[model samples]
Target chain A: MADNVIIEAPMPGVFYRRPDPEEPVFAEEGDDVDAGDKVALIGVMKSFHDVTVDTDGVVTEFLVDNESEVEAGDALLTVAPS
Target chain B: MFEKVLIANRGEIAIRIIQACRELGVTPVAIYSDTDENAKHVRLADEAYNVGGSVARKSYLDGETIIDTAERADAGAIHPGYGFLAENADFARAVEESECTWVGPPSDIMEQFGEKTQARNLMAETGVPIVPGTTDSIESADAVREFGDEHGFPVAIKAAGGGGGRGMRVVERDDDIDSEFEEARQEAEAYFSNPDVYVERFLDDPKHIEVQVLADEHGNVRHLGERDCSTQRRQQKLIEETPSPALDDEQRAALCETARQGVAEAGYVNAGTVEFLYQDGEYYFIEVNARIQVEHTVSEAVTGIDIVKWQLRIAAGEELDFDQSAVEPRDAAIEFRINAEDPSEGFEPMPGTIESYRPPRGIGIRVDDGVDEGDDIAPFYDSMFGKFVVTGQTREEAIERSKRALDETTIEGVPTTIPFHQQVLGDEQFRRAEHSTTYVEEQLDLE
Candidate 1:
């Protein structure tokens, strides 16, 4: 059985999966990510901040859609630890 | 007239715009964030759409999303009330490019006024008495010293792209100019994305007065008198009143005429304000607010001219039907900005759900608010939830009426600026119109 960990937004802002429209998404469901790996970006107050994964895991599901508004501590994605 | 107009803002200003739209027989479409999904502005609008997140960046400041929402709602025009994107030249251009009417001044004109030095140059060229300051950015401490030598010491180093008391520093002595100048430049870059700084002669006890002006596409401009907004804390206005007790008839006329001439020369259209700093008996031009202001209600009360309605009319290609003489201002009106702040605790924001909210009512009182009973005053936005405007035939009557109205108002669950306002109304210096911009912090005993 895999241990599920929820990735939460650190601040309130628009959650963007990709850094830019022309760029690929930072991380995707079913993709393996290491601790401290960038998963998404939160844009607020005319600037962008990176959201990173906390542990080495496979992204199980993205709880928030791309470019969706998010609040601090809201569950953004689910990850299953390796 | 537009079939539907989108108000790209939230709170009392949004509701204010909706009221204007309804009066003009135009449908009002409101945009809200996740936190403001059930806001009063959303409920009052003819139609409401969710823009994005709870924070302003993802929602209110997201120009692309707001324009897209306007398109989706079939809104022919957009009114950005006060804050957010109200003065954004890029947003105005975007709205224009998107084939929707931008209900403010021309974007190009806004661009010019957005830069402080350029605005000063323009005002000077228009025969308006501007504060003795650099018409361009100062590059070194030498230039600051030269300005000080020319205009005397106590110089103010300000950001060329900033306003509302941000990116400003006062150097009392020539020795402090170098560091203060560098600090001002850095603050300008951080706040306005412009590192340019300019020097000005700092006036120590100046009355903060501003004149409201309205213009249309045609060659018509009118001044709607002036408002004294000296009652402020850290440059944030707390109380404002019209028929500035600081100015006599001659001074008032000169101030208003100078403002109209300056704005007209800039080819500015729609509703705007020309702020000035008055010291001794002379008034010097400061900056132009290129959009409808929070204190427009005070001007509206005295002038009896609906500024929001005119913003819509001007954007719809309507001309100013009335001449300058037609704008007859009467009575004394005061506007108290009621923010959810704890005055005892250094005016820190105290955002919380309103358990019981009851605004003052009856004659001589009008309350423009965004929250209701049980509504949460979200931490994601500005602390101000409402404005209580009181009007009377005289300044004395207006002050007395405001006191009664403030007394009747009731709110629970969060600390408010009500107690502070009550104290201000009772203060002798405030009643005598002797308070300046620094009075709130320097003189007032908050305890």
Candidate 2:
């Protein structure tokens, strides 16, 4: 976990790699992220929101599976500083 | 009523207002934050628009942006559903001055009720029973101590501009008064930007009860009934039910009548709630919520009245069609707030995507939900996602049905208080209606 920053779930909801499964993910492993890059889509009931990167980094690992449920504070992805 | 009304809110309350608009044949325009682009309320509205960023300060709380959104959508009225800018007199005036009908009380009335001391004085002058306390801010510790001594021990030191328990301190004994008073004042300054505090006689083992009232432009005001909201943690109600078991027929009637008189005296029009604390067969006024309440569904279930629609009608200068005797309540109804919070962990907010969600539905069951199965519960907003309202022919039946409904309900991705509510429904004390305001903190073992 050295040199890696984990993007955690801020609330309880379902995580989506993209807006829909057919669409490309906003961010993926090996992709670079600015401070506010859209990372993933999270859904709770009928409401949907874009999860954004908190700091500049490179996506190192996808810690959560696509469409998987994530709780607040749960790790979703790990980002390594470029 | 206006052909279109903008609902400047999100979540179940917004959805509830939209439903009312649809029933009244008024177009509902929903404004969403960046986080609520695909919210249930947005999808359910006749028209929806993106207001601003995810932060409430930039979106829902931005009165100019919201009113502008309403104008762009051709909405002729704005229904601020509780919180955000609901009680903000400035926002109400802004909406009214913009040539848009505000589906609430007049801005002048709101200003009077928005001030704690002024509202208290008004209620007292109208013959409304208020908790024995100060009519003005306490200037010194000696004053607070004197008031406490006069009112007896166990006084509540409260910030003049406070609600939601932020700047309130309950001093149970004489020794704790000085320190608690200072702490309460500091908290008031830090939170509400007002250090002025007041003292009120604290009721021991009181039941949080409120009367649902509706008023129209034709000088008509009537109360639906009483709701017991005693099951609260941290001063926020988790469950609410109409026909408070703590109140007998006489007490209930008197409480409701007093609330009606208080609102009428204030020249308030539209849907509002008069809150009270009932103890030892007596009811004392606490405050008035100037908009629709979260527990309104319970009253609706029992009364079959569309409160939001009446707000629109009243704002449109229509008189209340039904008088006090004509509005009939047929049964008992209860509501449980479904929030994305882990009840086991001190009810800490658990904002995340709801992986799998299905609300229980059947006869006498009504769900006002703001999210679907896959929508994300945003951390930047209130944790509540929806409400489950159930009605039955009797209070016992409603309680039993509530347990069954909770059992059938399933929400994944985050922990909820469903199990806790189930336990509460079956608890002997709760079943017997013996619990008080402190029930959730003192009786229930959340751990």
Best by DockQ: 2
lDDT of each: 0.90, 0.85
Q: Write the per-residue lDDT of candidate 1 for residues A8-80, one digit (tens) a residue.
A: 8886666889988679999879999999999999765344679988889899999998876677789999989
In model 1, the runs with Cα more than 4 Å from the true position are: A1-82, B134-150, B157-199
Any runs in candidate 2 off by more than 4 Å, and if so which? Answer: A1-82, B134-152, B156-199
What TM-score quantifies how close candidate 1 is to the native fold? 0.80
Predicted complexes: DockQ each: 0.09, 0.10
Model 2 / residue A14 / CA error / Å = 16
Tens digits of per-residue lDDT for model 2, B1-447: 689999999998898888889888898899998878998898898789988877676798999988888888888999999889999999999999986889898898889888766787899999998889886899887887787778776788888887766778888764666677788889999999999988888887889999999998888998999899999988889999988888878887888899999999888888999998888787888888888889988888888888877888888999988889987788899899988777887776667678999899888799988899998777667888889998999999999888888888889987787877887887888999999999999987665
Instruction: Tell me model 1's lDDT, rounded to 2 decimals.
Output: 0.90
Q: lDDT of model 2 at residue B119? A: 84
The window of 10 residues in a row where model 1 chain B has the poorest summed lDDT is B172-181
Model 1 residue B172 CA deviation (Å) reads 5.5
Candidate 1, what DockQ? 0.09
